[model samples]
Target: MKKDKPKYRQIIDAAVIVIAENGYHQAQVSKIAKQAGVADGTIYLYFKNKEDILISVFSEKMSVFVENLKVIIQESITAQEMLARMIEGHFKVLSEDHHLAVVTQLELRQSNKDLRLKINHILKEYLDLLDDILQRGIQAGEFIEDMDLRLVRQVIFGTVDEVSTTWVMKDQKYDLVEMAPRVHEILLKGIQTQ
Candidate 1:
């Protein structure tokens, strides 16, 4: 598979920077190829076009992202702790990569309807992990008994997402990762069973 080749990752990584700096519509295949240190035609070997590259970037990065969260979740004994670690990990990862933050928080969200649909499909893995955590929390009495799992998942995910987007939009003026504990505390209080 093309993904198995070194250039594939090189191209994908390059595409991230290029798209983040140029925006998807302006991110040319030649620019990506140059960033990847390959020929323009080589991009076609790994992707159909700019749109495919964007989707692949989300797919590849999100797969690894969800796996890392699963590991962090497993390390915690309670759902609350797991959620905290998940928040920390999410914020830490994005903060460490400003370009990725910009791309995920802004650039990716600007894609066309069809592309957004595909991006949402890739996002399901991350959302499902959040749902699983909410289920575990309710089961363990860490959360309310009558909670709506779907709505709570959205709230949790949406809160973190909006916070990160705000940080990106504000030019990451403060410590985004440092906000994790506060976010965790606020979210915990909201869902914790009395």
Candidate 2:
């Protein structure tokens, strides 16, 4: 029996924890392998290099995130509600997974410019979800028609991202979910119907 190809996901999860705690610069393949309870050689089997592991982690987690968001938004009756749900969902996921949040918000940002660009590409799906809601809100007349979709999308995403980062930086003392309504309200101030 093929020794069930050591789940790459398990390695990735271990990488997230290791990277989150050690910071990207200090995290090594050997450390990740040790965290995952696997041999150092096992990592090379699943990834070409450390960078590949980082990118794979983001791609795998983010793709599922986008898919789940799409499904949730589809079930909602109104664009405004969908936007609120989206914001809440985004914060909920990050806040619940403290390791992933630290890796994404802090360690990932420490990556070199080229890797950052690659990560940005992986983030497009999530951004597209926001753009979809913004467009829908515009069509429904719930949001301002004059708004620049791209800029508004950035603002909305940036706002929630900042909130999450602050929560993480402050040792996550407060409940992150509770901030959802306030974040949604602040975002709406610039886009909501007059």
Best by TM-score: 1
TM-scores of all predicted structures:
0.98, 0.95
Residues 1-194 of candidate 2: C-alpha lDDT, one tens digit per residue:
21245568789889999999998888899999999999999898889999999998888778767987898788998888998998889888888899998987887888999999999999998999889888989999999999999999888989888898998899888999999998898888899999
Over the full model, what C-alpha lDDT does candidate 2 score relative to the true structure? Answer: 0.88
Q: lDDT tens digits, residues 45-67, model 1?
A: 88998899999998988877799
- Residue pairs clashing, model 1: none
lDDT, residue 59, model 1:
92
What is the lDDT, from 0 to 100, of the residue 153 in candidate 1?
86
